[model samples]
Target: MVMGIQQVSLSADGHRAAVVSLRDGVPSIYLIKNPFERRLVSDTLAPTVWAQRRLRQVPRLAPALALASEALRQRNPFLRDASYTTPPAGPLLAASEPAGSNGTNGHGEAPDSTRYGTLRVDFRNYVFSSAFDEARPPRATPSYYSSDPFAPKDNVDENGRYRPRRYRLYFTPDLVYGAAGYDMLYGVQSVTQMMFSDMLGNHRIWAATNLLVDLRNSDYLIAYSYLPRRTDWTVAVYHVARLLPDYALRTLYRYRHYGLNLSASYPLNKFERFDFGLAYMGVNQTDIGNLARPPVTRTLFYPSITYTRDVSVPGLLAPIGGHRLALQLSGSPGNLLYGRQIRFVTLLADARTYTSFGRGLYSFAFRLAGGASFGPNPQLFYSAGVENWINRRFDSFPIEDLTDFVFATPVLPLRATDINTLKGPYFGLFNAEFRFPLVAALLPGPLPILPLYNLQGTAFLDAGAVWGSPSNRRLNLFRRDEHGRQVLDDLRVAGGLGLRTIILGFPFRFDFAWPFDGRRFLHRRFYFSVGLDF
Candidate 1:
């Protein structure tokens, strides 16, 4: 909005209308009276001063005066005289003073004291535009104003909204070289956001050079995002993830196999969604030696679906029951295709729920989760014992034959035992956690300190094992001597506790756990890691 003199007409009972000239735009309260007409007038000389005082944001004269005085002293050396330097004035005097104390402002004296009140205006305008190219060479465009010329008002709508005009330019002689790597990606992405009729739309295209890389091993990925104007859904695609060079980072590390995966997730409701995808992997060698057979290639199609619902219970758990129950179930079935020896299928299932309590000084929260995974593996079981290097307790078992049981092939009803082969196809996972506020009360003020510190702890247990079947597995956990007698135990369990300190917007986590039966398993012990057992 622009500010100017709203009105300058005389009031109904005006006595000169209380006019006061502001030499420096500093307003003053004036009480006017015309004795000849016996009229009385009183008003605040400037309404702007009242608003400025409320914010206390107006720049002060002291700093500017100090800077100017210093500059002037450096040029003339005479102002350094203590008698010539001016001292600071009181606030009242500074607010209601004229620009000069001498006869005139360096020019001359005042004119006849009666013609008109010269009101000084502090006018400012803010103009914002991104269309104009600031980098254009000066010679390319004729210069009119020494400063940037104001945007042409005619190009804007009557209501002042700029009709966006996108401009594109390309330059040659550009050294456009690029590279890519795994997880870390750097590339250029182009996108546009626009409003069409009553809809909002967005489109994006991103190309990454190194999706994965090594001199001998590298990959590239191309992805894009799109949102149409008619629906409340977004579509994304990872068009490609191609390997470029191999054996780049670790020449010693073998390239088991790398492939592509494509998946899409669409929200079914506020609390439910579904995803589907497929991934293919080819391994020429296990972590050990390359197989006598060239290389095994497996293409698996995984179709997954899930449902979620929130259950809210009131006034049942705490002083202020902020309890909610959430449920989720998802599954994936994978198939491996190689030689006539097609492997058994794999399936997984998971579920979890949580509740929150309290609101004031002391708050609490609790959560629980459980999941199971069963898969077939002809090779040794790919599982390792925990190792806590940060805490100095390292207990990791060397690789060994893992398959020790065998049962049968799976059926439609999907009994747990159906997939439990002596090799792999196992199941086990459990988790629970709780949170508590560590503060007693907040300070008294408009901006009060909340529970700046909080304490959270968790207890968890995990157990996994395989069954017996046609999937011939090694007998590591339960081995039989040449006499065919049971010679080893089979069950393993672990329990752990976690202490978390939430401070200043960050969480510090420390966890410690011990085996219920801390004994030797395959000549190695088990220990907790950075608290992330999983």
Candidate 2:
């Protein structure tokens, strides 16, 4: 059966409902008390339905709402301007100007839009501009300026060139230690030097003083040197007391000299010069036993011309590649000056060359030096050793404990022979060496713990000979001809291998040499020394 409900009503007891309806196309009314009470029940459900719909939409609306809230909080004006569609990606412009301000184009017109310019914001930087000036061109700032308008500055002379400062002081210490056979010598030699230019407030005058002291030998030399700047002339007053080396290895002597010297030098070019000197020297020689020799007071004049040329690549401990040449001519005229007692003339030449094989890793070096004295012999040049020693013992005594000793003269090296075994007025010497890197080249990484690096190996050869002057041929003890003329027989020769490396920025060497000529009856020698090269 189908029924259409026209009206519905709740029962007064709240347990039954009734409906008046037309059923089966008939108008009929019926009432059921408590009908469907247990099976169907209804209550208000609109609020529950609305809450379910809101729960379904929460995920989509939450994030958008949060973003809107943030935008409202920030409220950036740039975002509000629709014309500024693209946000700035970098730093903003620091300055802005009106359309007709000074910051405009060359025609004094502003840009089409509001233009911006960059500005550095450092306190130490300054910007100067002539933008306000319309008629004149801008000026640039200068990098330098003189503090005084009328006086020179920064060591600049009147000619606009730099000159050396007027005052200087320097002090250097030299220490040497060596052992030969059973003899050892060690000492500290210090030199204190002071220089003053523009003496008496005159730029043409200069003065210098050098004082050298040997702590171990009790020897000293003081020299006062004065120079006339315009003329290249120098005058020196000096006093010296020092030992003179005697070729007789078993004996020693001393010399005391005081003198006044006048010298003039002129530079021919960058690498050559001529020097002339006049001196009045008073000399007294004394033996180790305090026995005095006849005194000789002399006034001597000498002139020398020296030419030197050097082209070298410098290295940490030594030069890697280059060559040097020097030639000198010097003469002491015996009777040219009053009270002159000796006369001599000398010519000297020296040449040295260095070659690198592998970009500073390996090198070959050689030196050739020769000198000859003619006329009269005033002083003898001794050869047999390479360097001067502060103390050299005749016997096998310990240098540290020995007290009864005398200062020895400066010894020039002729290497590969015993000390004080040769003396003469003429000499020629040659030296050659091969140097190569050793351990340092083989290692791959740095060694932080040790100061030693760049270990090097060396092989060397040294040869030299000395002879007396023609007038003093009888003093040539080494070799003589049938007519008693001095001969260059029995040339001294030595060959050796060595190790070299730097320690604490200083170069050190150890060498083992064997003499080939045996002129001094010396055997193999091992030497430990300090220096850049041989």
lDDT scores in order: 0.35, 0.54
What would the TM-scores of all predictions be? 0.43, 0.51
Task: For candidate 2, give the lDDT.
Answer: 0.54
Output the TM-score of candidate 2.
0.51
lDDT of 1 at 312: 32
Give the C-alpha miss distance for residue 234 in model 2, angstroms. 3.5
Question: What's model 1's overall lDDT?
Answer: 0.35
Pick the TM-score winner: 2
Per-residue lDDT tens digits for candidate 1, residues 1-534, read: 112333344556665554444434554434446524763364333223323334343333322233355656434322221112242221111112233566432223232121112532221232566556776655543332234455443457789787765543322221234432111011232222222221222543344343334422333444443445322232322222222121333212233334455545565666454544444433322221323434333433333444434343332222222333333322223344433232433344444444554543233333333233344443223223322222231122211221111112121111111122223344333434343444334344677655533454555454434433244433345566576765433334445555555444434455554444324323222232222212
The weakest ten consecutive residues by lDDT in model 2 span: 398-407
Task: Please list all clashing residue pairs in model 2, or write none if there are none.
Answer: 245-409, 385-413, 385-414, 386-413
Residue 423, candidate 2: Cα error in Å is 1.9
Best by lDDT: 2
